[model samples]
Target: MNLFPINAGNLKLDGGAMFGVVPKSLWQKTNPADANNMIDIATRCLLIEDGNRLILIDNGMGDKQSEKFFSYYHLWGNHTLDGSLKAHGFHRDDITDVFLTHLHFDHCGGSVQWNTNKTGYEPAFKNAHFWSNKDHWLWATQPNRREKASFLKENIIPLEESGQLKFTSLPENDLQNNSELGFDIFFASGHTDKQMIPLVKYKGKTIAFMADLLPTAGHLPLPYIMGYDTRPLLTLNEKEKFLNLAADNNYYLFLEHDANNEIITVKKTEKGVRLDTVYTTEEIFN
Candidate 1:
């Protein structure tokens, strides 16, 4: 099995929204904001090459949205989904599975693209099966008022329309065991309903894809939850349990939104679970 870090572009988001109630005095040190108070974030995706399957976990925000739409997020950087794939000697057509941690635009937007004729949309990964659990699929499709903005129809509906959408057959509360994709999925609800965090066993270490649950190493503390979460209180409880489990097992956390830090390890400290060491994929795997 081979794992690759795919750079899917970068964007800026309000630091206040990203850090929730955590004071700017605290989060700003780790993720220093610019004059507009927006911090740089990476739409970092993961690529898994195992035997016949090449699976991509979260393809990042795509370029299909209008300039006005992207302006809100302050999109920046030259990294793109297609360009990143080509850099690794691969292409969108080579992906056999797209394991979405959740249906948020930044995570799944790249899953679909505008067709050649520009008449309609189509699955971006022509040969891939897009993965989302039944609960998350339902939650995203029938989104509540709070999360409605994040779940865009243009980024989602096309996958189902193209007949490439598939749901993990796991039970609602199941947070253990691997899905058919060969990675154990932990269901987290605090961030959004049934956000599946893949626990991948690779090269004698467990790599947890920290999709929004733990956006960056700065978010390691229990109270550093995102304000965008539908249920902030629920997030606290879920994060506590997950971080402890991660620290106890010595898991390598693959961060999705962190621009500077790629992978992080946590250890139980007097204050709580804290960042232990940082590593590049090459540094850790080598």
Candidate 2:
């Protein structure tokens, strides 16, 4: 199996929103904010090439949205999803599966795109089976008022409408030792309902795709939760449990949102689990 870090794109988000109630004074030390108080954010998706199956985890926000719509997020960067795939000698059509950690626009928006005619929306990866758990699918489709803005219809409905959507079976508990996708899934609901965090095995190490559950190295602290999370208290509990497990097992965390830190490991310190070492995708994957 080969792992590739696919850079869909990069954007800037409000540091306050990203770090929740955590004071900027502390967060800025790690994720320094710009004059506008926006911090760098990356839509760093993962590509799993195992045999003939080319699985992509979380495509970034596609270019289909209007300029006015995108202005809110302050999208920037030269990394296009198609360009990234081409760099790896692949294309969207070659993707057999698109494993979405969640349906948030930044995470799964690129799953669908505008058709050539510009008449309607269609699955971005026409040949790929888009993956999302049943619970998350429902939660996103029928989004609550708080999360409604993040779950855009154009970014989501087309996958199901195109008949390419598939749901992963949830485990009885939060952690699924084995999933149909051939990896362990850590189901976290604090960020959003049933956000599936895939634990991929590679190079004798487990790489946990730290989606919104742990957006960046700065978020390693238990209290540094995202304000966007529906249940902040529940997030604290979930992060404590997951961080301890990651530290104990020496898992390499593949960060999805951190623009600067690509991969990292944690150690159990007196202050609880803290960042141990940071690594680029090249350092680890190569």
Candidate 3:
């Protein structure tokens, strides 16, 4: 199987919110903020070419939101979903599956787009079967007040409306086993309900897409949780346990929101499991 690093693009977010209660002095060293306190973040996606299926995981934020909406996130960079796909000698039509870790705009925003008529939304990948967990799908669509802003209806409704939305079955007691979850249904409730982090076996390596669970190397530290997470304590516990298993098993973690570091290795230490090494997607996948 071949793995492709799909860099959708970059956007800016408040560092304080991203780091939650972590002090600026600590987080700033890893992900330094700009004068406005906004930090650049990458909506990094992954393309999995296995057997006859060309699957894409999380299609970054698409260019459909209003100018005022886009301004809030401070979108930047030359990277784009279409451009990135073309760079890898592929196009949107070739994607057979779009495995969304969650329905957050930054993660699944690129899944739908405005039709040429500009009249209504359409599935960005017309031929692809969009994937999400049933529980998370319910949570996102019926979002609570705290997460309503992150789950935009425009980026969503259309997927189901297009008749392309599908849910991956949640394996029973799978999250308990580091090697469980027959097809990788990682139940990380802290970031969101049953966030589906796809585990791809590529080139004899276990490549697990680490969504908001371990967004960046800086978040490798146990307490460095995101303010956006609905349940901060759940995230802390989930991260610690997952990092320990990741370090023990030597798994490669793909960062979806990390603008700088791409892939990283975790190692156990006195301070707790920490980033032992970092690698760009090319270095590991290529």
Candidate 4:
């Protein structure tokens, strides 16, 4: 199997919110925030090429949102979904699966887009089966007030309309338990309901797509949970358990939002599980 890093784009978000409860004095060293308190984040996605199936995990925030809405996030950088795919000698039509970690705009927004001439909306990966669990699909389609803003209808409905929306259910734990998809999925509810984290076996190493579970390497500490989570307390428990499991198994965590650190390995520390080693995907695999 072959893997490629697909950088959808970069966007700025408030550092305080991204590193919930953690103050500027601590996180600023790593993710230096601007005067307005916003920090640059990478909407990094992953590409899996296993024979004919080319699966893309998370497409990053798309360009469909209005100017006013986008002004808040301040999307930056030249790395786009198309450019990233083309870098690997591929295209949107070449993708066969859009494996969503969840339906948040930053993660799956690039799954759909506006057609040319502003005619209507359509699936960005025209040939891909956009995958989301049944529960996650229901939660995102019928979002609560806390997460309503992140789940835009334009991004969510078009996949189903395109007849490419398929749920990653049935076998339930499709990744870990079923030995399907070349990874085991670990479910976490603290960030959002039914957030799927793929534990992929690539090359000879076990790598995990740490969606929002640990957005950045700076968030390695258990207490560094994001405030945007619906349940902050629940996040603490989720992170502790997941991080412990990651450490015990020696899993390589691929950070989606971390602009600096691509992949990180953590070891148990007295200060509550500090980052043991930091490296790139190439180093980990090679």
Model 3 bad stretches (over 4 Å): 174-183
lDDT of 3 by residue, 1-286 (tens): 7789999989999999999999999999999999999998999998988767888989888989889988998988899999999999999999998988899999999998899999998998989999887888999999999999999999999999888988777757536222322245567888888887666666677787998998888888899999999999988888887888789988899998899999998899999998888898879987
The candidate 2 region of ten consecutive residues with least summed lDDT is 173-182
Q: For candidate 2, give the lDDT of residue 116.
A: 93
Clashing pairs for predicted structure model 2, backbone only = none
Model 1 global lDDT (CA atoms, 0 to 1): 0.91
TM-score of each: 0.97, 0.98, 0.96, 0.95
Following a full C-alpha superposition, what root-mean-square deviation does model 2 have from the true structure? 0.8
Which predicted model would earn the best TM-score? 2
How far off is residue 141 in model 4, in Å?
Answer: 1.0
Report model 3's TM-score to 2 decimal places. Answer: 0.96
How do the residues 1-286 of candidate 1 rate in per-residue lDDT, one tens digit apiece?
A: 8888899999999999999999999999999999999999999999999999999999998888999988898878788888889988999999999999999999999988889998999998999999998888999999999999999999889888888899887654647676489988888888999998998899899999999899988898899989999888988998998899999999999999999999999999899999999999788655
Better of 1 and 3 by TM-score: 1
Query: Per-model C-alpha lDDT, please?
Result: 0.91, 0.93, 0.86, 0.86
Q: After superposition, how far is residue 208 of candidate 3 from its true place, in Å?
A: 1.3
